[model samples]
Target: MKHPLSQFNYCPLCGSAHFEAHNEKSNRCTECGFIYYFNPSSATVAFILNERHELLVCRRAKEPAKGTLDLPGGFIDMGETAEEGVAREVLEETGLIVEEAVYQFTLPNIYVYSGFPVHTLDMFFLCKVANTDSFKAMDDVAESFFLPLNEICLEAFGLDSVREGVKRFLKR
Candidate 1:
């Protein structure tokens, strides 16, 4: 049997099979002493609300939670600040430009892709859109709509992190 780290057999820089786990979260090349660390990716999701306090939600168009309700956000881009990344993602998914975002909280999540678990730090925000009329389902979103906070069904969210975020938001 092979350890999961064996999946990354060779050092990316030197192509040497001497690359082995230095720790649970990293690999080191014995030949060149180059180390590679497995780092969690940062992602963002927004809770967009109108004056009426109805929250905007989207249905994911892809797996691991296809067709399930999700917030209007995605992975933060490199070199982008969390606020900027979140706004961009919200705009891309829901077509609503975020005028402002208030950082709410963060959650650790495991996003499984192709049988490998990708860890993520998911940042949540309470956002105000520049315009509600701009709302539309776009990008990886199958549908977009609003639901009152009192009427929100957490079970409709496929991701546990998102569900927990919503639960916290409702309490706030």
Candidate 2:
């Protein structure tokens, strides 16, 4: 795997070509004395189960993992809490308003976006919804459905963190 900052050749702070690796996770610009560190972004995932205990799942409409199975969550925005981000993501992708979200676990993942590896700390949540009647696939989701826990295959999930997360979720 390439370094997360491998795509950069110039320093954004001073437009300096003297930028070089400062350490494993940072780069220093020799001309401007600016250091850029690579850090993981915060993301969220939801494991919503209906009364029958079927987990809600989605089909991705876009890459990184087009047409693969996914959960209803995304990156947490700058000013949002993890609970708020998970709820918003559930609403956006599945049209289901989350009444409550309980934090479960977290997993570190490398999400490849536009050929760049983005490190993320994916926080998992077990969500609750008051109604499923309004559910419809929206946003980046191609379709949405619920599957029994026994029927879910880890390999069907495209994202590594999600796959591992689901495996851990099921075991618990």
- In model 2, which residue pairs have backbone atoms overlapping below 3 Å? none
Could you tell me which 10 consecutive residues in candidate 1 have the lowest summed lDDT? Answer: 1-10
What is the C-alpha lDDT profile of model 1 across 115-134, one tens digit per residue? Answer: 77777899999888888866
**Residue 13 CA error for candidate 2 (Å)?**
1.4
What are the lDDT figures for the candidates, one per model? Answer: 0.88, 0.93
- lDDT per residue (tens digit) for residues 1-172 in model 2: 8888877899989999998999988999999999999899999999999889899999999999999999999999999999999999999898898999999999999999987899999999999997866689999999999999999999999999999999999998
RMSD of each: 2.1, 1.0
The TM-score measured for candidate 1 stands at 0.93
Model 1 steric clash pairs: none
Highest TM-score: give the candidate number.
Answer: 2
* Per-model TM-score on C-alpha atoms: 0.93, 0.96
Least well predicted 10-residue stretch by lDDT in candidate 2? 128-137
